[model samples]
Target: MRRTTFIESYGATCKNWTWSWSFVNKTQRFVIFGAWQEDSHHIAGRHLILDEHWATRIPKGSTKARRQPGYPQAIEHLSRVAEEGYALFTFPIWQASVGKTGAGRDPSSIGRFEPRLTPKTLVHEGGMWWAQDLSVVALHSEPDVQDDLADVGAPELGRDEGHSKPTGPGHYFPRDRKVREDVLKKSGEKCERKGCSEQLRYKSFLDVHHILGIAKSDRVTNCVALCPNCHRDAHYSPNKDALNKQLHAYARKRPSN
Candidate 1:
């Protein structure tokens, strides 16, 4: 099975995007293919793929700007094919290019605006400055495109089916100790129920509860710390305010130590 990948760049009203494909084999750099938008309505570039004994370059001329074959199309196609088990790798290319006027004015002339420069040359003239902003897409193909398709497709199925699970508590907890610690500290080691603050003193007494349940994992701000008593009351109490009253009662009983 061979591996394949697709990539593309889109041109904004004020900027063009470029795409390039490159890889290394035994210390040799090989550029497979590249594409870019030179203007608002055209994409042009070339790519070279090296075989075991030879190299093949595919020259892409300007094509009419169409919504179908642009970045959106490549993304959709690559995603769909990858879901079926294809091995594809798509990445962006950041290149250097000259900063020229949208109207293709002379590089040397500073009309109303001062010179805007990029890592790439706007004019290949001896002293012209260049700046970096160009990007491109590189697509790779193996001996058999079908093999590549299967490689990407299998993993995509697992992702789409929701079979992936996080190994830790909060999404932020596993990655950031500071955030977790800050949340625990700010919660005063107690349940956030309006009246249940008295029951919390140690970490063991508190549980971080998601107000809307686990199904809404994306809702991070909806979580709060709660002591076991308050946690249970929040769920089982006939009236939600009962937990608030309990917290208030707990506060009243505590000595002002």
Candidate 2:
């Protein structure tokens, strides 16, 4: 067999390093290795994952710590990397939040070592592209266990401790800007209402319509991308019942995770 050596090749030079020199200097695409903190700073192993706390320390790639442009390209690249059974190496950066507005960018992890295709929530309403579960290649000293990720399954969208429930179920704002954008991105920004072709606009004009009614369910599987006219028809038009049924069937028929 032809032994692969990308990871092995970097072994000699991989060390406790900063992003400016290590990450930015590479002429080719690179993986985030690992990161350090103010007090405890050291590279441990080759494929070991760092604790969740280290995520925030990943380097910034954009101004004001905004969503970096390299994220989508990274996702496309890392998805292949994961399938090829390789992990990414890099520092983390800030990910701006976007929900119902459907106006922001797809969230990707900025830290070293992305999970080729990280696990996503299937049953949950939001198709959240989680950032913290990725592995760090600098923590483990054993032989390669990177292939262990092949069987990884969908996990719950676990809420961190001290999470505040401002009101009872579904009392939050309706224009959920962040979740909507994720749905649109997942849907490829095309109108999900069967054969409808949404007229392109300068910015996104398609409403992330709730097929099952927001009062009933605001989950991802219950949402659909629709033009403004189709959006109104899904609600107040005389044929709304039939239109809504079509959307529901479409939403459930497609896979979310």
Candidate 3:
């Protein structure tokens, strides 16, 4: 993507005119920019760094060093993006200077990546939560389990005691693109609503609605393809519960093809 386009896109999602290390757009897709300072900082693995506001060296839970201004929001963003199986786009910058117009830009390695959720250490610690061990895998590939672990260092299991396993239910339910694509395909590129007559238009795609909740499963049985309008109705309409029931019933009746 062009620098101008990147700035405009990031600016729309973020208040700051300047681009930060990472920002998730309205659609929950993550835009991560690689930095020279992060490389110089020896941050261990190939991780998506966050803004400096979250880089407090003071350990987490320290009364003296409270959470930074954006720390809580950063953590929430990480959770939602990961849970929803959002795509993360990376742009590598060569120099430490953000002002340079054409910083050492690497084009070959630019690609969409998914976070390898199997990090041995907890994602949140020391007032930070960043995705570590990213691999350029196919978007439709299976969830988690990085294909390339040859270069990734083993989890520093004992390094940070405070970091614990991600707890609670529904922690890591990444939506499967394969299932979503299948649902869209089964819908024949048209909105699956009973009476709606929406067709897929140029440069437009249907949104896959999870009738049974994305946290439960990304299986085709639990999903339906709907246009933006119908999708909104499924979530926001006063009779959404009934609509969801109908969608789920339709999904079950459709062939697996």
Model 3 alpha-carbon miss at residue 178, Å: 1.0
TM-score versus the correct structure, for each prediction: 0.25, 0.32, 0.35
lDDT of each residue in 1-257, candidate 2, tens digit only: 11113333444132322221122113343344323221222222111122323222333443333333443333333343332223444332232333322332222332223222222111111322122233321122111111122111211322111133323321212245555766677677777777887653534555677665432355677777776567657755788789989988888777754
Better of 1 and 3 by lDDT: 3
User: Which scores better on TM-score, 1 or 2?
Assistant: 2
By TM-score, the better pick of 1 and 3 is 3
The residue-by-residue lDDT of candidate 3 on 9-49, one tens digit each, is 55424433232334456654554434322454325443434
Give one clash count per candidate, in the order shown.
43, 33, 0
lDDT of 1 by residue, 37-70 (tens): 2242121222111111111222224333222222
Q: What's the ranking of the predictions by TM-score, best on top?
A: 3, 2, 1
Q: At residue 100, what lDDT does model 2 achieve? A: 25
Error of 3 at 66 (Å): 37
The number of clashing residue pairs in model 2 is 33
